[model samples]
Target: MNLYTFGKALVKTALTPLYRFEVTGTEKFPDQGGILLCANHIHALDPPVVGMTSPRTVHFMAKEELFKVPVLGRILPQVNAFPVKRGMSDREALRSALKLLKNGEVVGLFPEGTRSTDGVLKKGLSGAGFFALRGNADVMPCAIIGPYKPFRKVKVVYGEPVLMEPYRERKASVEEVTAVIMASIQKLLDENSEK
Candidate 1:
């Protein structure tokens, strides 16, 4: 495995016993090239959970303040995570994401823009749809179930990739497209969760 993939595996191994990590439908993930992974964020650990569980290297957009933490700041960039300014669409952040995509690197985006306090899927921003359209990349809708906590069985369910062409040509507004994407994510959550 590549260094990034190895590092992710190590993280997964370390975290698994702490929190019961059970991921299914990982086979649905694309085996190669770039992909835009859109997921519902419910906790601060969501990004790392997805990053470590995914079959390929997944990059995350973190808040700028996170980079100030001595340990996390050093480790994040090493593991393909970069900083973004929260509460604003930082153009530089978007550009950095786009650059990764253009180079066939996968990027993980939380459509809710931040973690959901109630652990329920919320209305998503249009950034995901916009990225898929602008990047000409497929969006892999993912659903993360359970609280990411010690001894909890947290599941990361990845769905088949959703192509952008149909959505882009549908004449629907960006908000409409985002709604559709969020709905798909909710469906995955409803079906995959331990009921």
Candidate 2:
């Protein structure tokens, strides 16, 4: 097996017994073509959980700092992660993401930019919207709920893909497109809150 598949298998096996993990709405994920997986950030563990549950290999736009770590720096790229300088537009990272999408790959990102320590969804950054419009890609809103503690139930829900055709054709502003994506993510969060 490849490194990603092997790593995902290891995580799934280890986390399943520690947390009651569940996944739903996976059929909504596209079988092919470029697509963006936008999700809300709740914890550090969020990305791995989302990646493992996804139907395709998810290339994450991780913070540049993670790539600074000796071992992680080497491993992350191999597993499809590229670093982005947080709080500022990193042109290189943006180009990388766009390139991946253009090549029909799945790129996952947390719109909030960083993990929400208090568990409240924060305002989304405009990068995701920019990528969707520029790359002519579909955006899939995903919500991850809990695993707050060991043995706690954790759920990952994938919502219907938000087609960028209409928004792109309308020349919607970045903020507008971002709002639509965030709203979709919020809806998923609300729907799965009790689960």
Candidate 3:
């Protein structure tokens, strides 16, 4: 198995016993083809849980700083995580994500751009909307429910794919598209819980 698969297996092995990680709405996920897994970020663990539970390998956009860390930098690439500058428009990161989508790969994005310390769903960045509009990929709204604590049940809910046809082949602003994606995510958060 590749590093991502092997590592994901390890995560599941370790986490399943420590925390009851539950995944639902996976049947709603597309079996193949390019797709975006846009989720609300609450913890550092968000990315791995989302990636590991996903039906496909997810090429995630992580912060540029993490790549500078000694061992993590080496491992990030092997697991399909590219880095992005946090504050400014990181063209390099955008290009990497687009290329991956063009090749029919899954890309995970946290529209909020950073972890929400209080676990509240915050307004998402327009970058995620840009990806949905620019790439020929289905945008799937995802939510990570529950706090990341040992022995706690954390759930990853994959909601229905947000339809982007109206915005496709047209001139829709990124913010407008992002609102729709965020709304979808909100609905999932409304319906499910960690309990």
Candidate 4:
């Protein structure tokens, strides 16, 4: 395996026991092939928490500003994450995501586009829906509940995959497709919230 894959595995393995980790509906994740893992953003720690618990390597997009720093830039790429400009439609980021999916790599995305200060599902951006249609990948809804601080227990839930066919038709608007993607994540969150 490449350094990125190895590093991700190492971090995930080490962190798994640190949190009171409980994963529900993980079987819903595809056993193989490219998959778009759509997740609801709750905290900054949500990425690694979900990434480590996932059964496969998940390539995600990080903010470009984070890459401007010397150390983070180097490490982010090593973990299979690329930088995307904030407040803009970054075609390059989108293309990179699509390329990863096309190559059969699992891509993790926060449809909210950013973390929510309050632990609630937010409106999703169209970028995820756009990539799903372009790459012909299945959108797997993920819900991560609870906090990361104080080294307490947390919960991450993966929901059933939502295929891209119904929205692939040209008649469907991007906003409509994005809404559907968010709804899937929201449903998972609602189901797993108490835990």
Candidate 5:
């Protein structure tokens, strides 16, 4: 097996005891074709957690700084991660994601662009919306619920794919798609975070 698969199993096995991973709504996720897994950013672990819970390999758009962090820098690429320069339009990163999606790969992204220290959902960035529109992949909204508490449940909810058909048909704006993504994530958190 590849390093990505091996690491995924290893992480899951090790963390299962420390945290209860309750994943739901995976049935709503598309089984094939390209997918953009957009989720709320709560912590640094969110990307790996999302990767493990996904039914497919997730190519995460990580921060550029992460790729400069010694061992993590080298390891991130092996695990299907690419760097994105935040705060401005990073066209290179955008092209990379679009290429992956065009080739029927799953790309994971945090709509908020960075981790939320308070574990609250932040406004979705238009950059994420650009990825959705340009990639032409299934825009699958996701949510990772709960603060990092030892021995507590870390719930992940994958909401149904956003209806990008109409958006694509009319060539809608990026902000329009961002709004839909944020709302879907909020809905998932509201319904599933209680338990």
Candidate 6:
């Protein structure tokens, strides 16, 4: 197996039991081509949880600080993660993500830009929409629930892909596209909560 696949297997084996991990709608993930996986950020585990459960290999946009850690810096890139400066638009990171999408790779991002301390869905930054529009990629809304305690059930749900074609062609405002993405993520969370 490739490095990413091997790492994913190792993570799944190690954490699935501890987190009681569950995943759904993985079939909704596209088998090929460029796509964006936009998810809500809660805990630090959110990225790996979503990434491992996804059928497609996801190159995640992670905070730049994480890359500074000695060990993480070396390992994250091997697993398809690139660093992004938070609280501002990092053009270099944007360019990298765009290039990945252009190559028909899946890029994962948290629209909220940062983890929510309260676990509440927050307003998304415009970057997600910007990438979707520019890359002509479908945005897949994903929700990750629970794992609040060790061995507690943690679920990852992937919603239908939101086609960017309509918004892209109409030149929709960044706010509009971002709103749609946030709403979709919220809806997924809401639905999962009811279960």
Q: Judged by TM-score, which candidate is best?
A: 2
Instruction: Compose the digit string of candidate 5's lDDT tens values, residues 53-163.
Output: 999999998889999999999999999999999877888898999999988899998988778888878998887778788887879989899766899988999988986
> How high is the CA lDDT of each candidate model?
0.83, 0.90, 0.89, 0.83, 0.88, 0.88
What is candidate 4's lDDT per residue for 167-192, written digit by digit as tens?
77665676787899899888877777
lDDT of 5: 0.88
Instruction: Residues 31-101, candidate 2: write the lDDT tens digits.
Output: 99999999999888888999899999999988899999999999998888998898787999989999999
The digit string of per-residue lDDT tens for model 1 on 1-195 reads: 655777777877888889987888889887776689999988877887888888888888888998999887887788888899988879999899888876888999999987789988888988876777667677889999987778978888998788777876775576777777898899899998777
Q: List the residue pairs that clash in candidate 5.
A: none
Please report the TM-score between candidate 2 and the true structure.
0.97
Model 2 residue 179 lDDT score: 92
What's the CA error at residue 17 for candidate 6, in Å? 1.4
Q: Tens digits of per-residue lDDT for model 3 on 142-162?
A: 989988888988889999888
Model 6, residue 31: C-alpha shift (Å): 1.0
Clashes of each: 0, 0, 0, 0, 0, 0
Candidate 4 segments whose C-alpha is farther than 4 A from its true place = none
Using alpha carbons, what is the TM-score of model 3?
0.96
190, model 4: CA deviation in Å?
0.9
Best by lDDT: 2
lDDT by residue for model 6 (1-195), tens: 777888888988988778777788988888888998999999988887887899989999888888999998888999999998887778999899999998999999999988898888999999888898998688999998874588888878999999999998899988899999999999999988745
Model with the higher TM-score, candidate 2 or 3:
2
- Give, for candidate 4, the lowest lDDT window spanning 10 residues: 165-174
Check candidate 2 and list the clashing pairs. none
